[model samples]
Target: METITTFGPLTPAAEIAAAFPSSVQGKNIIVTGVSPNSLGLATADAFACQSPANLIVTGRSYDKVEASITSLRSKYPNIQYHALIMDLASQSSVRDAAAKINQDDKIPTIDILVNNAGVMAIPALTLSEDGIETTFATNHLGHFLFTNLILPKIIKAAQRSSTPTRIINVTSFGHQFSPVRFSDINFSKRAADLPTAERPDLEKTEFFTGSSHAEDTYYGFFSYAQSKTANILFSVALNQRLWAQYGIASFAVHPGAVGTNINRHATPSEIEQALKRAAELGFDAASKTPEQGANSSVLAAVDPGLSLVDVAADEVTGVYIADCRVDDANVARFATNGHLAEKLWSLSEGLVQQKFE
Candidate 1:
């Protein structure tokens, strides 16, 4: 398929900012995870300049949400701003937030939704209140619900006004590890039997001690990889559903490693230092500033030429993108093994059947 050679890794956000069409002048856009202190804030800032009809920013914490809104308002005094508190780990919160956004009086339609929030490697396994794994809960399931909930409003608005609605799932390249384990998602039974650190002395040591699952056996990196891969698979599946019917195109993006605070989930210092060293060497594992990381997400959300892709297309959808461009290798793998993607989608759906169905 034909591709844009201009899009490249380490592509500056300013380049993306330059590509945004002037047509978004009065459009309604909602960006999740845009707390004042996060990379989402940079994304909101970039989009804020385009003067959308309404800009709604969200975060898991109320304080961060308010702070982000306050900062944006001061920076862009004339731009429309709205802020909401949401924790993606909780299904009820996702449902409530979507409902509230759909019902807002000023916002007659929803144009673009960006799912940019994510968590990294957590040493210990934990579950959300809804009883799903924390990593899977926050990274994939929450955004899935948010998109579906607001889809109708977005589609209706798009239909009435001829405005295209876009859903961008922010993903990562680290999703190359173990595919989804459909059988055991929550690790409920496993978590229950695991010995806590408080138990100092170990009497019978036939296997792993602190964590029931050995680090080598069930690497934290593998769990993270599974979640990120789910993000991509969800986007591909979602794109097929929405693009054919509603003309609402969905895309997944792996914002090349950026030096951000997405690593707040009990990651080891050794891993942290490794990331730092890799960043210095200009590897795919590196992190850019918050602004740089937010660029691709904004592009996927607002760029008008998204739906145009061919099978031979380089850097295309239903594939993984890194450094602001698509990876050819991932595309080929996905095209061949669609079952993996299908299985992940089904497994995720099963886990959250209560909230979504």
Candidate 2:
């Protein structure tokens, strides 16, 4: 594996694949939330061009998954593509998808798993079929269960391969908006009423909770932020538990701001307001093309420069990648808290009624 000296925020995914072709060649990669114009599709397309053994794409809709795979097959005819219908909000759906992958004869091992599917800023407080908050369930818990269920395959791939098997959680810079509200994860309690310790940043609380803190004041972005924070924590705990023992490296990636349908739940006015808040936090909030947005994830998945050995040796809090490089300054302190990561891992296990060792 070769290393690149520099990669900018606007670096193209193709350039990453070209830089480390061996990292992707003959590897089995799975990317969730892939549709025609989604960031997941862009990531998959990058891997496809590099001659991966299998490019498995997943989404909630069969039509969308089929369309994405069809388009990719047309352009990269030599590559193999598999479509799995997975509704990340539903635990049952995630289980079925993972089971299929494990039972499928063609998918012997999973070299890369990109937990890229997610919903953002859902305007209302919706619940999944399992009765958990929709945003949290879809963005964090769903991927949690799915990844754990598929651990066998990922570990198997790592055992046979020289390069580490990678798991990329597509998180966001929006994680700065809020930490995981452990006490009020579902936001059943008012953010203002939570203990001061629970609400670490009062200003951020006011931003997401609003001044009123009314009972019905459900801030969609707050829930989205909490889930994104969970994504990073999950990666932290995952890497800690699996890196040295199983040769698996996990990364949380902020794929810049890409124009995609993840915001379909938000109205134009809401989007405008969110942008204003983002600017206040000193974030660029500039939009990138799907291809460019996929760069960070592509880099996290294949860049030989990243070392799980170093992460394990240092016992670093967590690894958060942005703009195709390790950029921890942008991550919220709570997102990288090792204790929080362990707590989240336990909570996730209890919620899913299963444990991954």
Candidate 3:
């Protein structure tokens, strides 16, 4: 199927990886959330094939990180692979990981940072030790803190190289399902499960988060949507800031529907309903393999075309990309909300209890 952006039928990850031997070769890249059989793993795999100078695979478990390193070493025995343990679920873990990475003399700079780690559709309303909601903390706040901490390294790398630095935040097209729950993001009163009649107007039915899922139920879908929205807004705001101040390029990518660990949380009945809906939509395949799924992100990471945006007026360009091309953000107002982005940025700083400034 052709993408809405009109540029591709979706290039597979291998072809995309092989296409940019020059750009990716010898570049120091960090890919987060790379466990076995996952999106980040596939992405890191493709990147390793491109002969990166160093590939940093970061995840929650030391065993997982070691497993990824061992797996990648079998394929690219020569390229350097470093394992860094950083759990996105814990603020202290994130802080400790960042501090270690910064102090490491060997990892002096990073050319590309792919924020692909995320927690999705968690069935329960879990929170981090810092008391922030689970999905929001893992999907948004963890990346938020990690990025700010490593941003100096990315900047250092950009300063030395003539090329622009890149930060790719992997978001989801499902962002339309919900926006930031400004008043009660922590679910103090079960914001997602509030009485339908009393629920906020935006959640009731907006281009994003509005659905036929019943007016009085919580599906945990909207929680994921809200976090994805945070990803999009964060990209826009980050690009705008970094471009204005440092000239680095940042992007948000929707790595099409791909089969991965995220589906594990769904109940059998829920999965059945999803498959039924996908079948109803003209028998379209609801999911793709990790290679196919990693296209947009790999493209975002190496595509020379994305560099053109930085040349336009200011670094104020952050577009939602999918299937290897720039696509609409589905018109979710919050994606373009600078005020809300700034507010979320500030709120995130407090939640993680850290300030980049």
Q: Pick the TM-score winner.
A: 2
Model 2, C-alpha of 137: deviation from truth (Å): 0.5
State in Å the error of residue 308, model 1: 3.7
Per-model TM against the reference: 0.82, 0.93, 0.87
Q: Model 2 reaches what TM-score against the true structure?
A: 0.93
Sort the predicted structures by lDDT, highest score first.
2, 3, 1
In lDDT terms, which candidate is top? 2
Q: What TM-score does model 1 achieve against the real structure? A: 0.82
Tens-place lDDT per residue, model 3, 279-341, is 655434467788788878877777665643332332233467777777653436666566767
Sort the predicted structures by TM-score, highest score first: 2, 3, 1
Error of 3 at 95 (Å): 0.7
Better TM-score candidate (1, 2): 2
**CA lDDT scores, all candidates in order:** 0.67, 0.85, 0.75
Candidate 2, residue 268: lDDT: 76
lDDT of 3: 0.75
Backbone collisions counted per model: 8, 0, 3
